[model samples]
Target: MTQYPHSPENPMCQHQPVCPSAEATDREAARIIACFPEQGWSLLCNGVIVFEDTGELLPDGSSIAPHRGPARHALAA
Candidate 1:
C-alpha cells in the first residue's frame, strides 16, 4: 500500500515492470500494428496508421489493439 501523503484518488501507482519494459512495449506494439486484425487498423489518406480502439496514436504510426474487444471499427474521417 502507498504510504505517501498523496491523494487516494490519484495515489502514486506502485506497479513496476514485470516483463515488458518500454522497449518491449514498443516492439510488441510494432508487431501488433504490422499484423493487426482487420478491425484494429486504419490507413490514413497520407498513409499513416491510426489505432481505432483507445485513440492513442501509435508511436510508430499505428496502434496496439486493445486486448479484450473484438477490435475497433474503421477510423472516422
Candidate 2:
C-alpha cells in the first residue's frame, strides 16, 4: 500500500505547512472557493474537488486519488 506525503500519520499539509498554526476565519471573513467538511473535501477554481484524504475530483470529471501518488512526486522520482 502506498502512502501520501501528507496523510494523518505524517501530519504535514503540503498545501499549507503551517495550517495547524494559522488562524482560520469563516467564509464571511475569507473568500472560499468551496468546502465540504463532512466529506473532508473542497473544490478548486477549475471545478476540481481536492480532498483532505489526498484525493481529487478534476474539472473534467476525472479522479486523481492519493496513494497513486501526486504528479510532482512521480515526476521527481
Candidate 3:
C-alpha cells in the first residue's frame, strides 16, 4: 500500500469546508484535487482516486467497487 504524506486524521485540505476523510462513508464527496478526464479518473483531497464508473481506490490501497444505484425505469402510459 502507498503511504501519503498526510494521514486521514490530519488532511491538508484548504477548502472552506474541508474535504471528507478517506475513511469516511462519504469520502467520495471530497473536493477533486486533481482530475484526468482523458483517463476517466480523479484524485480527491482525501487521497482517494475515483473513476468515472464510480469505482474508487482508497489511500490504503483497498478498492471500493462501483456502487451506482439501480437504473430507474420509465413508467408505461
**Steric clashes per prediction:** 0, 0, 0
TM-score preference between candidates 2 and 3, better one:
3
- Quote the lDDT for 46 in model 1: 24
State model 3's lDDT. Answer: 0.82
lDDT by residue (36-64, candidate 1, tens digit) is 65777553222234455545443355545
TM-scores of all predicted structures: 0.22, 0.42, 0.75
Candidate 2 lDDT score at position 28:
21
Best candidate, TM-score: 3
Give per-residue CA lDDT, model 3, range 1-77, as digits (tens): 54445544637665656678888888987889899999999999888999999999998999999988765663332
By lDDT, the candidates rank as 3, 2, 1
Worst 10 residues of 1 by lDDT: 13-22
Arranged by TM-score, best first = 3, 2, 1
| Candidate 1 backbone collisions, by pair | none
lDDT of each: 0.37, 0.47, 0.82
lDDT of 3 at 67: 89
Q: Cα deviation of 36 in candidate 2 (Å)?
A: 1.3
Instruction: Give the per-residue lDDT digits (tens) of candidate 2, residues 1-62.
Output: 54436535223333333222112221122223678899798754334456787666654576
RMSD of each: 13.9, 15.3, 6.2
- Of models 1 and 2, which has the larger TM-score? 2
Q: Counting only residues 3 or more apart in sequence or on different chains, how many pairs clash (N, Cα, C under 3 Å) in candidate 3?
A: 0
